[model samples]
Target: MAPTTDPATTDLDRVIGFTIPGRHARGRVARLGPVLHAILSAHAYPPVIERLLAESLTLTALLGTTLKNAEGQMTLQAQTEKGIVSLMVCDYKDGELRGYVKFDAERLARLGKNPSLHALFNKGYLAITFDQVTTKERYQGIVPLDGETIAQAAESYFLQSEQIPSVVRLGVRRDAQGMLIAGGIFLQHLPEGEVGRERLHVRLDHPEWQHVEAMGATMGADELADPALPLETLVWRLFNEEPEVRLLGGTSLARGCRCDATYIQQVLTKFPETERAEMADENGVISVDCAFCSTKFPIALADFVPDAL
Candidate 1:
């Protein structure tokens, strides 16, 4: 029988990253594990598309963790000719994260399995938004689509927006039984000054940079998505060469959508009174489906009118 849960074993459901010794570089590996299993279980997606979304989720989580600035969420979105594309930004603050995506199924279908990010989103621009709940101001960075894959696009975003040089590798795959698995690794250039520059320069000057210094075995898809693999072991296996490597505690990741009745009611109120009445059902209830989570909510007609209005 396939194992259910084993805390001692390393599995495909964890995210791990590492900092290279003597180099101002860091790498990360993340596996969606059971959380992704739960999220996609109820939904039917083609293996290609499923993998795409899964990788996006994992990448989002990794980026969210790396980019620490405020206590609110970071949002990544794209408007494509194929359809509306989106990624939720969740942070460590209060464990709050949410996101959704809308794609043209027909268009995506024509593209076939394993569609390129550029092919799926031709002529689209990426927008990264940072929302601070406590403050009234929301900051946004917009950039043109440059990369061919999600990883490339994201790396471009970081370079252009934050001026941080990073290398990101993303993968999405499914098993023989149709189980979805998404995983990725990110190598980033840590901020450095004169001392740091000198260190990297000396290392590069050495012939060892060209030699294959096998520290550990190459990581495979099975290892990345396996829930049985302990995160620490995985990190050690991939990056034990780094003497100064530090293990930041792993954070739990999930598929969460920030859609509900209250927000829907506020949006409906903005429509004309006639349009609002037309949308009402026979029982005088207005039903709306959240674009993110597909949660349906019914609002009473009386709730539409504000007490002050």
Candidate 2:
């Protein structure tokens, strides 16, 4: 891919949506900057684990933005008991994103510089969940993490669960300034079906889908990682040959950690007195650390909680 020269700063740290009228395809592009670095730098993880988390966050952004609901939550989790990586989770809600990883460092060191999806997670599965706030409903889809990359697993989710023809590409690497930047592109053809089975299935052999998939494939890793390239320019570069391409609204993204003293205390109050007491330090203060952001909240029982209650 050629280097990008477009001066589109607005595209940074956000997800941009678009659709191709002639191609009957729609997609989302997410390029993260400070948000990506802030999340990864907070933890001292191996490069391979960092890359996996990067891709997870990128994919979450891509899939989360597709929700029409203004208050929906999207979560992606990949985990296995007998692998280098025990669990990796990333979630998105209304432009807020937070994620973390739990892995076996000793097992991870056993792998090479780079590890395949199966190598990282043996007999693992990728679960994509969406919590629709308006409808008060939740839906989840799980698929075997068989492919070499998370992108391939996502395509499987679309095929087996959503039944949409999809193409996904994700990349994570240091830029010219040595800052970690993550970017991804997702494309799916408009579904039109077969007249066969009792249940409808997307026609896997549509010319329109084939053409769109070909266009999506041409998107290079360099192009996705370049921060200078405006998202509009990125999409145009890929689908400009089509009759028409429309760019939708964009949403800014930031790392979100919903941890606070009051919230922690509320949770603590519900626990058994003995359990809460056990959690307290010698000074009778419960030090709560957020799993996502690693922020610490210390609450003193002396003043905050009554001895009788």
Candidate 3:
């Protein structure tokens, strides 16, 4: 049963996490669900690649919710030589969410049967970018892929780049029906001095923090890829016991690319006049494909002309 949403209901199918001891306190556990899965399935991807992309998508969405601003987009990108490179970007516009990914078919085919992230991407870097569309500037942080798995790499990224201690566990699996399922949980220690020291220090001393005690749950690809699991059940089974868990309300997720014909025309116009003229034929048409969604956009020579010119 899929989780349903009602404005009056306190419980809705969505990612939920909260800081303990009030607004000033730190520490949180964010969860992801259907909304994220929907966004990841926009493209037809091999099983292993799809799972990795899903995990990245969920992480990006969780971060989007945690880091709210007036108008911005959050991006998670990884550069890999295995031909399995990927990038997920989520835009937050009036609480609506949209995202997409790009992968190499040849590499995806080779890695489809292998479920190991380390095996697929022997060496790479995970990067996070926050772009405030309303403003011209953007903030980005990148870290080396230090861990063997996606979760570990992400955890390392958060700890090293953000300077916030965090544990991120992401899982993707399929069910009997072959639906894709992806879920993730993130736990972070409140920054020091943000909350009272005595209580914060005591909690940090707990055994879970001594070592990575969090375990990522195995979700059948079908379950994650499927459009049906009740969001409440998913969260309850995964993180209900964590004392600090808080439901922050759910956000809708979908697969979408912002590329269009006008953008393609703009790109082609950037080429040197000689190069542009050489590539153009008597008909003066240019065809461009979106790198992320693979959608083709065609522009006419007239469209490339500057209005001022």
Using all chains and alpha carbons, the TM-scores for the candidates as numbered come to 0.77, 0.91, 0.72
Which candidate's TM-score is highest? 2
Candidate 2, residue 91: Cα displacement in angstroms equals 0.7
The 10-residue segment of model 2 with minimum total lDDT is 1-10
RMSD of 1: 4.7
Model 2, stretches more than 4 Å misplaced? Answer: 1-10, 192-204, 303-309
Best by lDDT: 2
Judging by lDDT, tell me the better candidate of 2 and 3: 2
Weakest ten-residue segment in model 1 by summed lDDT: 208-217
- Report how far off residue 15 is in candidate 3 (Å): 2.7
Off by over 4 Å in 3: 1-13, 22-44, 81-112, 133-137, 175-177, 192-246, 306-309
Please write out the lDDT profile of model 2 over residues 203-291, one tens digit for every residue: 45667778888888988777887787788888988877887888898988988877788888888888777787888889999898887
Model 1 misplaced stretches (Cα beyond 4 Å)? 1-13, 16-21, 67-70, 82-98, 132-139, 175-177, 193-222, 266-275, 305-309
Evaluated against the true structure, the overall lDDT of model 3 is 0.57
